[model samples]
Target: MDYIGWAWLFVIVVCIVIEATTMGLTTIWFGIGAIVAWITSGLGFRLEVQIFVFLVVSILCLVLTRPIAVKKLKIGKIRTNADSIIGECVKVITTINNINNEGTVKARGQIWSARSFNDEVIEKDEIVCVKEITGVRLIVERKK
Candidate 1:
């Protein structure tokens, strides 16, 4: 009905579009806030009051619901095949020398370039545990 109402409508549309594209449970709260502000503007509320309501409502929605929404939606990082090898024991097929940058290990029937996690030299035929994967190389530490 007014310029403030139009602005709130625009904010609502933009927030909705962003939420739709990301699906990350963000921006939806701001859309809700904008809707409230739009209604406030339609009710002849002052611009300052409308803005304050928008901010408070948006922050309250985000703080009160985001964690619960994230938990219920099970939104979290998805592990990959490489992540599964972390903490797995593997046999070093070649000497691991961080200085020389030469090493190999066999894991799950696959040979992967390996490196010592702490830059220590690990002799060939030693048992090591996979610590992390960087690019095509596996960072390992000698098994106790």
Candidate 2:
């Protein structure tokens, strides 16, 4: 109904739009806090008090609500296909070249695409450990 109301509504709208695009609760809480400021202003509060309330409430909401929101928004730990092999150990099932690619490893009782981390050919059936996985490819090295 006035300039302060319009300003608060603008902030809320902008924050909501940003949160929509970013898909994070970061701005949404601030927007809600701004709405609270608008309410305070509508209740005949001074601009200073409204701004202070907005800042305090926004910080509090962001600190308190964000963690819960983030925990709920996640889809478990491993979202990508590569993340599935984080803790899996693999054994060398094929020979690896020192200069080329083309290797295989047995991980979790399943054969997966493998490569040498140091370009060393690991013999067939050699004991190798899956150190890290990168985009469906396993970077393996000899165990001993």
Candidate 3:
């Protein structure tokens, strides 16, 4: 009803918008704090008390719940479409001799430059698992 209440409402809306845009979990805590401050203002609390309540509640929410929320939200390995190919089996289209610096692999229907992870010479058509990626090259190991 008062200016404090309006200000807190604005904060809540802005924070929510930022959270939705980035999905980074950064400002939702401030939104929760603004809600508490809005309610405090509605209950006729002084401006200083409202602000204090907002800061304390916001910090508490961030410190107490953020880690748990992040862990729970991470249900499985988070990977982009390109990164999802890591650990997948691929066929060596070209000989992968780390010493000779020649290697290529066909992964996900795309030819990618590759290197042997253990420095072993891998001949063409051998199946290898992608271990990691560095720059434009796939680090690969023999598939066990």
Which model scores highest in TM-score? 1
Model 1, 40-133: lDDT tens per residue? 9999999999999999999999999999999888766555688899999999999999999899999999999999999999999999999999
Measured by lDDT, the strongest candidate is: 1
- Reference-based lDDT, each prediction: 0.95, 0.82, 0.93
Clash count of each predicted structure = 0, 0, 0
Over 1-144, each residue of candidate 3 has an lDDT whose tens digit, in order, gives 877789999999999999998887889999999999999999999999999999999999999998888888863446567778898999999999989889999998999999999999999999999999887899999999
- Assess candidate 2 and give its TM-score to the true structure: 0.67
lDDT of 3 at 58: 99
Q: Give TM-scores for every candidate, taking all chains together and pairing residue i with residue i.
A: 0.73, 0.67, 0.73
* Model 1 spans > 4 angstroms off: 91-94, 99-102, 109-113, 117-119, 123-127, 131-137, 142-144
lDDT of 3 at 73: 82
- Candidate 1 backbone collisions, by pair: none
Candidate 3 root-mean-square deviation in Å: 3.6
- Against the correct fold, how does model 1 do in TM-score? 0.73
lDDT of 2 by residue, 62-141 (tens): 89988888888872344655566665556677786656677888766777888877888888878787778877788877
